[model samples]
Target: MAKILIILDERTLYLYQNNQVVRSFPVAIGKASTPTPTGNFSIINKLKNPYNKALGTRWMQFTHRMHGIHGNNQPSSIGKAISNGCVRMYNKDAEFLYDRVSIGTPVEIRQNRRTDSKNKSGYSYYTVKTGDTLYQIAKKFNTTVEKIIAINPNIKNKNTIYPGQQIKIPD
Candidate 1:
C-alpha cells in the first residue's frame, strides 16, 4: 500500500511505497492565520477536474470535507503558504499524485520544526535573484543541488526561481 506524508513546515509532500520514498513534490500550505490541520487521515474521495477552476485539475478529498489536497491554478503559489488550510500543489504534480494514489491511502500531515533555517553547522540564507537556479546557488556555495533542495523544500522547481525568494545554504 502507498502512503502519503505531508510535511507542512517543509511544504513538501512525499509518496512512500514499502517504506521508501518514491516521489516528492513541492506544495503550498495554509497561511499562518489559517493553518492546515496536522493529523493522520485517509483519502476519502477523488475528483477529476472538479467544477472549481481554482482547484486546478484534480482534487483528493481527505477525511475532512472542507479541506483536501488539490491542484491550484496559480503555479507561482506552489511553494508558498497562502491556502485556506488545504494543501495545494501544481496541476501537473497534483494529477501525478492523484493518479498514483487511491481512495483510503493513508495521509499523514505533520509539522517538522527541525527544518528551521538554523542548523548545527550554522547555515546562511540567500535571497534568490533573477535567472537563479539551484545549480547556480549550489555552485556558489560549494555544495550540491540536492543539498540545497533538501534544505529548502518550499522550492518546487529547482530550475525555476524568482527574485526576492529566500533559500537556505548549507555551510
Candidate 2:
C-alpha cells in the first residue's frame, strides 16, 4: 500500500510510494472552529458517489472518525480552509486518489505549527534547526538569504537564528 501525507497548513496531500512523492493535490481543510485532526492514520473505507451533495463523487475515509478525504461540489474550495472537518478535494482528484490507494494505506495528517508558513501564493515555511545557517538554509530551499530576509522583516539578525524559529520560504 502507498503512504499519504496531508499537510494542513500547506493545503496539500502528497501520495508517496517507496518514500517518494508520486502525486500531490491541493485540498481544502476544516474551518478554524473544526480543525482537521492530526496524526498517523489509515484509509479505512472507500466509496464511489457517496450520494451526499457535499461529499461529491468519491470518499476516502481515514481512521479519524467522521473525517475523510472526499470530493466536494464546490471545486473552488479545493485549497481553502472551509470544510467542517474533513479534507475536500476535486472529484477527479478524489477519484484518482481512491483508485491509487487501498483501504490499508497509511495516512498522515499534520499541522506544522512551528512553521505555519503556507500562504495563498503557494509559499512554504521552514523552521530553523541547530547548526543551521542562512546560507545553508537558502541553498536547501533553493532561495537566497537576501530574499528570505526581505520577506521576513521580523528577522533582525540574519546571522543568528534560534532553533525552532519559523521562517518563510517564498515560492
Work out the TM-score per prediction: 0.65, 0.65
Residue 46 miss distance in model 2 (angstroms): 0.7
- What local distance difference test score does each model get? 0.81, 0.81
Per-residue accuracy of model 1 over 29-97 as CA lDDT, tens digit each: 987656676556899989999999999999998855478999998999988889988999989999999
Candidate 2 structure quality by residue, lDDT tens digits, 37-155: 65567989899998798998999898546889999899999889898889999898999998899998998776664443347865567756556778877875678889888888788
TM-score of 2: 0.65
Model 2, stretches more than 4 Å misplaced? 113-171
Worst 10 residues of 1 by lDDT: 110-119
